[model samples]
Target: SQQGEEDPQALSIQEGENATMNCSYKTSINNLQWYRQNSGRGLVHLILIRSNEREKHSGRLRVTLDTSKKSSSLLITASRAADTASYFCATAERSDTGRRALTFGSGTRLQVQP
Candidate 1:
């Protein structure tokens, strides 16, 4: 599988702080996506950075992609306790044709304490 690898398996911080997570992959991908899961429930799409793109931002979320390094990072500003969750990065093969067969990283567990 082409699942990406994440670092800092776990993280903890107080509310109003910022949370940052990273992902690394071995193979080429069409795009990299960041998702958040609360209590191990469903995943919520946070951002998607295309291989050709360098960086993107949405609301309080900022994502940076380094295709040369095959790595990506997600940064959340002013994090809140409600932001506590697991963040995952999934890689889609360059030839993917709309399938969930994507390989996902182990994910970073973030804890935002109030």
Candidate 2:
């Protein structure tokens, strides 16, 4: 599969602590994005970092991309119980169809305990 692979498939952390997830891909990418999904809900966009960027932050999320390593990491700071969800990393690449396609990782399940 062209999709990236996420590390630490499951994580448990106390509320107010930080949670980190990693993803590694095999090909060059235009950009990488992080998303969060709650049970029975649709995915929510978290952050996006372009290949030219080393890091980007939004709210409590900090995303870092390393094109040299074809990898990326997402960090959620001061996590709350409400932050419990499955986080996924998706990479945008130019497909043979000449369109940008997104390949997603399996995802990391984060459980924030109160």
Candidate 3:
């Protein structure tokens, strides 16, 4: 698959600490998006940075993209117990016909202890 893969499948951190995850993809992509899934809850969009962009930030979330390395990183600052969730990186590929749906990575499960 042309999808990305996140390292350190799982992580544990104390509340108020920061959590960082890395993702690596195989093929070229049009855009990359980060999402968070809370237990049984649906995935929520965190940020979307195009291939042309280097880095972007939203609230306490910061994302960086390195197209040359085919990798990306996500950082959540001052995390809370509620911040515990599975984070995924998805790649949007260009299609000859139309825009294709995102291809998700294995994901990184984060646990924040209060």
The CA lDDT of each predicted structure is 0.89, 0.90, 0.92
On lDDT, the leading prediction is 3
Clashes of 2: 0
- Alpha-carbon runs more than 4 Å astray in model 2: 95-98
Tens-place lDDT per residue, model 3, 33-87, is: 9999998999999999998999999999999999999999999999999999999
Pairs that collide in candidate 2 are none
Q: Cα deviation in Å at residue 88, candidate 1?
A: 0.4
Candidate 2, residues 56-109: lDDT per residue as tens digits? 989999999999989899999999999999999999884566478788999999
RMSD of each: 1.9, 1.8, 1.5
The true-versus-predicted C-alpha distance at residue 57 of model 2, in Å, is: 0.6
Q: What stretches of model 1 exceed 4 Å from their correct place? A: 96-100
Residue-level error in angstroms, candidate 3, position 80: 0.6
For model 3, give the RMSD to the true fold: 1.5
Superposed on all Cα atoms, model 1 deviates from the true structure by an RMSD in Å of 1.9
lDDT of 2: 0.90
* Candidates by lDDT, descending order: 3, 2, 1
What is the TM-score (0 to 1) of candidate 2?
Answer: 0.93
Q: List the candidates ranked by TM-score, beginning with the highest.
A: 3, 2, 1
> Candidate 1's residue-wise lDDT over 2-107, tens digit each?
3598877999999999988989998888899998888849989889898899999999999999988899999999999898899999888787466646788998
